[model samples]
Target: MTVIAVTGHLHLTDPTVHLVRAALGRLLAGHPAAALTGVSCLAPGADALFADAVLAAGGALVAVIPSPAYRDTLDAGYTAEFDRLRHAAAEVLVLPFDTPDADAYEAANTELLRRADLLVAVWDGLPGNGRGGTAHMVAAARRAGIPVEVVWPEGAGRRPAPPA
Candidate 1:
């Protein structure tokens, strides 16, 4: 089976969300449903979109939560979707961290990379602003010899301000 992991920005515009979903769906369509396993953190933006596409394509999902309190850090609006995705995951891995912090996020990213055979990034080809960002993960994946596929569809763009 081929394992695909995702990393991307969480602040996407509405139009960009549709574009990302379509792009991810098209990519997932290239593989046999039963042979594809998607790994993600199930975060609000790209991660959630990837998980949805994986489930729609009949692929298994593996969710890697950054910390035990990761759910608490999510916006209230995303809780239901996050819970649904978590419930749908074939395997749920909660890291040893107690809280959601930068270090915890970085560790989670490392674990995702370690488990992924291929990394499907929904990045906009920009440099990451800080640690554990999509750009950082992509670079790490390349260094580890994991194949990386960037999925930034035409006209897709990030929101001007990040989600609060």
Candidate 2:
């Protein structure tokens, strides 16, 4: 079985979302449906997109929630998508944390890498803003010898980082 994990920005533009979906579809095309498994955190942007593609491709999905209160911390706009992905996951593993903090997110990222044979990074070819971001995870995956496929389709750009 091919187990793929996803890491990316949470705030993506509409066009970027479509591009990401198409890119994921292309990446998953060769793998047999039953032999494919996608791992994700079900976060708003790339994570959610990857999970959707996995399901559409008749592949199993495994969700690694960052914390017990992860749902509570989601933006209202993303609540529906998050709930849908969580419900559709073949397996849901919530880390041992009460809130969605940096530590919890890092732990979740670690678990994702541990379970994945490959990582699909929807990145902008830039450094991550902080510790648990997509760039950090991509670097970690590479350091651990996990193959990472960076997907940044043409014209895709990131939303401005939130003020610190």
Candidate 3:
């Protein structure tokens, strides 16, 4: 059984989100619900979308919140999203402590990857040489010998296409 963990940027909407959802749906189409377990960080955008798809496919949704008192720390938008996930997820696990910043998000990502057999990432290019987000998480997963599935829409980061 594959325990899949999904990590992605929370800033997307509409076509990008739609494209990612469709891509993930297609990628998961052949797997049985019984053979899959899902984990998400419960953020907006891709995280929520992945959880929804997992549920729709009759797979369990395990939400790993960054903090137990997340409502106290998150902005109104994120708080609302967390509440929605509380109701939607079959299981929810709050991290033992709060993260202070980007480092914490990375730590949380590592934890999720540690428990996952597969890591699915949805990333939008953030310019420059920093890799503290989903990109870092994918690299870590690869280093740990877990398979990674990256789903970014066409032109997401401007990777050049092969010549016709």
Clashes of each: 0, 0, 0
lDDT of 1: 0.94
TM-score-better candidate, 2 vs 3: 2
Worst 10 residues of 1 by lDDT: 155-164
How good is model 1 by TM-score? 0.97
Worst 10 residues of 3 by lDDT: 155-164
lDDT of 3 by residue, 3-119 (tens): 899977766756676788888887777679988788988777678878877877778888877766555755576677678777878787777765535655666787788789888
**What TM-score does each of the candidates earn?**
0.97, 0.97, 0.82
lDDT of 1 by residue, 15-128 (tens): 999999999999999999989999999999999999999999999999999999999999899999999999999999999998988888899999999999999999999898
Residue pairs with clashing backbones, model 3: none
Decide which is better by lDDT, 2 or 3. 2
RMSD of 3: 6.3
Report lDDT (Cα) of residue 90, candidate 2: 98
Predicted model with the maximum lDDT:
1
